[model samples]
Target: MEKTNSASRFVDLVQTKKSFEDIKYWTWSEMLIALKQCQESPSLTNSSIMLKKCIDLLSQKISLADGASSSASSVNSSRFRSSCDSKSTESLKTNFASTTWWFEDLLFFSTECLEMFVQSMVSHEFDQVLLSKFLIHFQKSKFFNATSDVKMKVIESVIDMLDTLDENVLSLKALFDILRVTLGLNINKGSKNRLEAMIGSKLGHATLDNLLVPSPYGANYLYDVNLVLRLFKAFLSGGINQASPSQLAKAANLMDSYMVEVAPDPCLKSSKFLALAKVIPDSARKSYDEMYYAIDLYFEMHVGMSEEEKEKICCALNHKKLSYEVRIHLSKNPKFPLKSTPSSPESQQPETENLLQNINYSKSLISWPHNLTEGINTDEKEDKSSEQIVLYHGKFDLPADNERFKVHLEGMQWRVLELEKLCRKMQTQMRKILKSRVASSYCQVKSLPKLCS
Candidate 1:
């Protein structure tokens, strides 16, 4: 009986040792399971303990992964470098996948707990102060440079909370801080491509429309508008050309709507138009046509713009070549208005009955080496064959800006100055001619009188 009792104690001791070892060497999957069990637990205190334990493990794993990545990069050799790169990429993928799964699970668990706690507090069954304390503690916990997935999940949760909760209850600053934190993260090309795919996905994965649709007819509308605008500006500016065409268009459309309704400032409106004009893809013919339409729209919208704004618009227009039809439209508008008195005295004009009367408008404005009338005659296609050949041969050496207004004005001034100089020279020559004729006539009269005497 004594030997049997000792054997039973030994087995119990062995079992205890194995359990402790298992907890000591917890795998990522095991940590995830532990979090899940905590999420299902009825006791909040026990669940909190379990959550803390899982979070600690996650932090350690992330630290280990980051340290490994940093260390692995130091290894260098032409032969081994490719092998190392492959291994590192595979390791990163595995780590990213695991972290993404863990983040999603945590988000689900936290949101569910938050909702339940909020309900309990409303029913007076949960302590409001305690709930507040829990929130504060959670907020202050060290994230240890969390992955993008974690950041995105937090942003999504904050947005969801703002959408669902009353404005009076949520701290707007805290929510904004969450978004700012996400935006502050380093945006590499790989991340940018993923974000672009998300924004442009026809399936609506991470679609901006789905994530940040504006509210209607309330303070919430204004709130949402500001949030969405900030989010887009940060994204577009940070990523620059990373956005897909459809995504770019969608963002532009949203900003345009905001400009029309919320921001009535002409300069602000013009800015949005400029951004839209820049983002349109110009590689394909269809996209080029779309850009042409955008340029026309921008011109139409900014008709009465200030000189500075017009200058900015002109600068942008000069950056890209417009289609033939668009160029024609631009010629009708000409360039932005110059000041009545040009900065250069040479370009300044005197007031006259017709300021442009002396100017050869057609010759001054047209940069072409050929006849203006022939160029204007769209029906004379055969006559333009040479011009077309030159254009194609030169790979379309088309100028971007409408230099017509400035060139025409300057040319007219120059021609007027030349004509005035010529007139002065002619007057001097004519005066000399008259003087010689008078002298000859006087000599003839005097000689005739002497002969008569």
Candidate 2:
């Protein structure tokens, strides 16, 4: 009975040590299971805390393994330099290579743990601080600093995890910070330029749209419009031509929306807007036009006196006169024909001239009543006839017999009388100025002639 009791105690001791050993090297999957179990248990809050600590410790061990592997690799490489010709050196190299593989496996395992933990934390509503710690660990991991292929895989994993996270629990600041860091590293290494086109292609429009235009917080929109604008600008500036057509389209759409919401003041300038306009694809022209119209409307609404004033404002909005020029260009395209294309050579030669003639005739028709209010003098009639002669050239021929034409002619006649009265008013002011100038000149000339005589 005493021996059996001792044997049972020994078995229990062995089991406890094994449990401790298992915790020390806990796989990510095991840690997750333990965490879930602790979460479910009523009296396991302390156990959960302890498990978290264990997971953290395991993460540290993984980091140490990386450092140890790097050091070992360096040492092995040095040994090759010292003893290249020795038989033992070959054996040492083989052994070192195998050891390195073991370290790599450990790192791979740790990466798996990190990925799972990130997903778990995101899903389970872990503390922001804990999530941040996980992100920091992730950023510091060997997987993050791996080859482009490897890093992209890790990035994809993170993005997938992002999809699963609850919006309320997801830490925007933390995510942004991680993205910023990753982007910085990519930028530093010149990998971001290569990755951008791929990111656009893989993520597609909907994902990007969601990221850029998230739900509004208070008055603040999802992402900072300015920041998102800058990010897209950076991506395009890097080498957007390499991106897929859909990616280019998505980028242009986002940029168009961003320009409207943020209304980048710099983009209104000649040099900047011109530079960016070149990159906008044909697929996104409609979006660009909409943004342009919105900006035009905004300026008109905010600055103009009336709708007519707004029309004038629209004409002047683009500093480079690009708006009208672009309209003409678009109108000329075979795909989008102009609404009022002049078929005849005569009609085409002077649309503006014809428009001006119509405008003058309309003005004459409207001004008839005003002429009657003010009387015309004799000198003013000669000036009025000269103006009427100018108005009647080549185009603008009036019909002689139609009742409507007769009414229009009568109105124009009244306007001519009004013009004569205005001419008389202007003639009186001009005559007075001329008299003063002539008197002064005459006095000077007379004095000059007297002096000469």
Best by lDDT: 2
lDDT of 2 by residue, 129-226 (tens): 43444444454474554786566556555544444444344444445544554542333333443333334333324333434443223433333443
Where does candidate 1 stray beyond 4 Å? 1-108, 111-268, 275-292, 298-304, 334-453
- TM-scores of all models? 0.29, 0.29
Model 1, residue 206: distance off in Å is 10
Q: Candidate 1's residue-wise lDDT over 1-453, tens digit each?
A: 644443343334334433322332444444555555556653644456445544544443443443322322233222223333444446545757442322333343465544443343333322233333334334334244756666554444434333333333444344433434545444344433433323332211123233343333344233244344434544555353565655565555544343334333333355654554444233311223344344445545557767777555455443233444454555454433443112322122232213344343322333222222223453464445444434333222224433444456567778767766665675566567657766887978643121111
Query: The CA-based lDDT of model 1 is what?
Result: 0.42
Candidate 2 pairs with clashing backbones: 371-418
Model 2 alpha-carbon miss at residue 202, Å: 14
